[model samples]
Target chain A: MFEVENLTKKYDGFTLDGVSFKIERGYITGFIGANGAGKSTTLRSMLGVIKPDSGKVRAFGLDFEKNEQEIKNRIAFSSGAFDYYSHERADRVAKYYSNFFAKWDNEKYEHYKKVFSLDGKKKVRDFSAGMKVKFSLALALSHGAELFVFDEPTSGLDPIARDEMLTIFQDIVADGQKSVLYSTHITSDLDKCADYILFIHEGKIILDGTKEDIISEHTIVYGEKEQAATVKEKAIGIKENAYSFSALMKKSDAHSLSLTQEIPNLEDIMVYYSKGGKR
Target chain B: MSKNLKRRGTLCAILKKELFLATPLPFYLFALLGLMTAIPSYPIIVGIGYVALAIFNSDGFRRSNRDVEFTCTLPVERKDVVTSKTIFVVVIELLTLVFGVVGALLSVFLSSPNGNVVGLDPNLTFFGVAFSCFGVFNICYIPGYFKTGYKSGIPVLKGTIALLLVYSLVETAVNVVPRFNVIFDSLWGDFVFARAIVLVVGVIAYIILTVVANRIAQKRFEKVSL
Candidate 1:
């Protein structure tokens, strides 16, 4: 339902050059990138919060510029940093938000408030960072949004909160009418919650596809230096530790059973690709 | 309808947030009116009361909140958010005018002996000036709001410094030439025209600032990562 096409933005020190991606109506798309990789810029352009220097963004098949308000009603977002209204209590903030958003579900807000065990009367600024992230998620979900765009939602949370958030995200996408674009440095979260992974590096998308397609299409190989000759020119980075070495190869070219071993993880592949498939 | 058009509630949500931020200004209006009504002179009381209304609302334009970052994320257009805030300032101006006039009229009625003649026309000048003051507030505020979400030190600091410079310039001009006031009084008949000019300038400036502010908001919002 969301399409970001050839989006470009420029700053004095950084640039997001012709980035493009699409999120299907129901799948969770994880935007994985390192710091300064333009992931956030892509998200902002998609939301039309920042106008791309060039190219068009279509949400629900309508141009974002022409139909910004209409499209916004069905979308919710939580920022990378877990900040909230410092002076207002959590319940008060929720109530204030309810007045403007007709779709806001008070019951859902209340339910999540309880689930997260947030004290309704406490000012948001008093809450810990993890608590703030939970509150932000609860608020986003309570709005009954069709799309959830989270910018590093798991940044400051404890492990338990992170696990709980992942569970909540999985449940959120179960309805199939809902979609998400989760941008984060946490590779593990993508493994658990994302269906499609888009890897951004140096302001461009290096690789993007379903988890299985990426993992299945790539294989990890290891042995002596002579085996490197048999591998494709694009070896996805090699690790050398004293006596042995390991390298990743395209699975289509390398027979898995014949290869020394296979290691599959989003992080390994990202590191492999970012290093220009060197081995 | 396009999917985006089908889901347009985000703008209202943004306006709601702005309204909460602005609601406290009206209380200042009431307090200023109460203080002014206690004064014995009707015309003077009325004129100053109107000025107080403008000033009270101006105070609301003083600070900026960084929390605007949160609001910018919801699916609302930046223009809509700017429009909502502009509408909010207009509402505050109107409410202040109503309260100032009522308070002035009541003080005149209560304190005057046997319905003595008192000039109510000058109060219209007061209204004009107050309206202009509200206009100035908006002009300064809207642009500032977009630049820093009122949180960063730059926009507000610049506004404050500019306002102080303007205030000093006006004060200096008023002190320098008695001839200027006499000439001004002849044209405006005791500052009515001056207040009217200010009111008009304020409004024109407000409109121009709003358009600029709207564009700035759109740009800033799009650049916002979250």
Candidate 2:
């Protein structure tokens, strides 16, 4: 449903160079990156929020620049910042947003408000961080959006709220018609809900594939320092300590070495890659 | 709805949100300060009200941080955002002008039976000066605010300085230069034709400023990152 090609944007100290990715319908694509890794910049460029120096972003098969309003009308973008209408009451904000969206469902808005336990009369600034995220999600879901782009929606939420958000996201894409492109530093949230993972570090896409494929292909091997040294050249990302070390290698590579292999989760992979991965 | 109609709806929505976020304090303050026009020599008080309104209006994006969400997430185009804000500024300036005129009329009625004051008539000149002030201020403020979003301090400062300089230059010409004073008096002091000419020129300048401001703001805002 969304495609970004060679998206490049330059700033004072950082540049997002040739970043490209795509998200299909009916799946949650997790955009994972460390802080200042150009995740938000890439998303903003895709949304036509920040114009890229040169590149193209297509949404729903339409060029974003040429059909910006039409494309935006069909997508709902939510962020944890909640900077849209901080001073207005929740209901008033809903009313204001409803005017722009053609398919805005007031009934759905009321349903989500009750489900999220959002008080319509309260100013947005008064809401807790978790409440603010929930309110943003509620707005995103009420507009009949086919694609939901959420930036750090679960960043500051408690464990329970994060789980609830993941469940909600799962439900959103269950029908195989809607999709979500979620960007966050929290890899655990993706473990619970994402179908595809796009890993970015230092403005480059280091990994992009199905979650199952990525988890199955990479294995974390633990060994003494000497064994780690022998495998250092072949391992993708390596971490060392005083007496022992662990390295991430493909399951195929580990099978031939006769080393102890531990199943690597999303966090383990991201941690290793972010720490010392070359690619 | 038609695409143009939908875009208009979006613009209206944006305008509504801006007005709501622009809190009523500035309007109240303008009204209170506008009462200064009751005294003839303090007509500059009305100008102060206009300047204050311009500053506060330009500060709206920074005060609320609305530009980020508006530019990034909302479905509206950057041009629409600029257009709606330009319309809002014009509307507010017009309201300030109306209030200033009302206050001047009230002062005239109370001061004398013939509705004449000791100094300037405070009718055409008041609008002329007010519109000119808005034109100059917005010519500076809008493009800067659009370029940098909330970091428009330099532009607003320059605009204010430009405003003061223009007024000072005009004041100096009327006071220091004798031949200029005679011509200024002929045009501004009593001739209805000359006053109408000034009003027309002010209106034209205001329109040109609004158009130019919107164009520059749209271009700059389109390039600005959230």
Candidate 3:
């Protein structure tokens, strides 16, 4: 449903170089990267918030530049920063945004408001950080959008709030008619909800595949220092101590070695790949 | 709704939001000051003050990081954002002018004959000066605001300086140059045709400046990275 091709943006000290990825419908795609890894930059380019030096972003089979209004109408974007009208109350915000979207559902907004336990009469500035994020989610879900693009939606939330957010995300895609592209540093959140994973590092997409495939195919091996040296040529993201070492390797390769092999998680894969591990 | 209707809805939404975000105290205070002043040029002062207040309020939104968040996440085109802003300014300018005219007329009628109350003729000149100030402000402020997102302090400062410089030049021409003085006197004299021509030309200039400013702002804002 969404695709980015050769997206490039250059700053004085950083450059997003030839980053590309595709997100399909009916599932959540986790855009995971470390700080300054260009995840936010890529998301901004996809939304036309940041103009790319060279690229093409296609969403819902339409070019972003040519069909901005239509494309934006069919998608909802939210950020945890919540830079919207902080001085105003939730009711006022809803009233203003309601006019911009023809598909804006008042009932859905009310439903989410109750579910989130938000008071419409209170100024947004007075709300807690978690409340602000919940307010943003309420707005995003009320517009009947086919795609939801979020930037660090779980960053400042408490454990319970984060869990609720993840559950809401799952519920959003439960019908298989909508999709989500969520960019976040919280790999554990993705392990619970994301179906596909796209890992970016230093302006490059280091890995892209199904979450299960990436986790099941890669093995983390722990062995003696001498054994680590023998397998160093084939290992990825090798970490060493005085007596023992651990490295990431393919399950196929781990069978040949007499070392303890363990299945990896999203965080393990991200750590290994970001540390120069092979795909 | 249809496409045009949706576009209009979006514009209205922006206008509504801007109106709510901008504090009206400055506009009201300046308008009240203009109403109480005996000076014939109070309208120009008030108009310029209104422009400054608008710029300051817009910059406040940017400083607080609300503008990017509000505008970028909205389901509207960048051009729509520019258009709505320009429309808001135009509406405010028109309201200011109307209030100025009413205050001027009231001052003329209420003051004693011996007092320093001005007639409609002098009030017309004040309106002309005020209109010119608005034109210059629009030319400077809109494009500058668009190019820099919402950090419009520099643009507004430059616009005010440019307005004063242009006004000083015009004043010098009328006072110092003989030929120009003659033309100015003719225009200022009680000739209905000349006054009508000046009014028509001023209206046309304001419209042209507004259109040009909107176009430039739209183009610049389209390329702006949020």
Judging by DockQ against the true structure, name the best candidate.
2
Q: Rate the local accuracy (lDDT) of all candidates.
A: 0.65, 0.77, 0.76
**Native interface contacts kept by each candidate, as a fraction:** 0.52, 0.70, 0.64
Task: Report residue A241 deviation for candidate 3 (angstroms).
Answer: 2.9
lDDT of 1 at A130: 77
Q: Which digits, one per residue and each the tens of the lDDT, describe model 3 over residues B1-226? A: 6988878887887777665554334543444443432444232353445556655565675558456546767778888788877886776677666776666567566544433322222244345655676777788988998896767788788777766765566556655787644443331344545545655666677788888999999999888877
Which stretch of 10 consecutive residues in model 2 chain A shows the poorest summed lDDT? Answer: A79-88
Residue-level lDDT tens digits of model 2 in A47-152: 8777889888888889989889888888988765465667678888788778778889999999999998999999988988888888888888888899998888
lDDT for B181 in candidate 3 is 46
Q: What DockQ would you assign to candidate 1?
A: 0.33
Give the candidate number with the greatest lDDT.
2
- In order, what is each prediction's RMSD in angstroms? 6.2, 2.8, 3.4
- The order by descending TM-score is 2, 3, 1
Runs of candidate 1 exceeding 4 Å displacement: A225-232, A256-259, A277-279, B1-15, B21-65, B87-141, B144-226
Which 10-residue window of candidate 3 chain B scores lowest in summed lDDT? B114-123
The lDDT of model 2 is: 0.77
Query: What tens-digit string does per-residue lDDT give for candidate 1 at A1-279?
Result: 988788888888888888888888888888998888888888877776555788888888888778776677678877664565566778877786665565888899889889888888998788887788788878878888888898888887777888888887888889899998899888988888789999998889877889889888887887775565555465667765556667767776667436587757898887776766443
State how far residue B160 of model 2 sits from its true place (Å).
1.3
The 10-residue segment with the lowest total lDDT in model 1 chain A: A225-234
Off by over 4 Å in 3: A277-279, B21-37, B40-47, B62-65, B109-122, B177-193
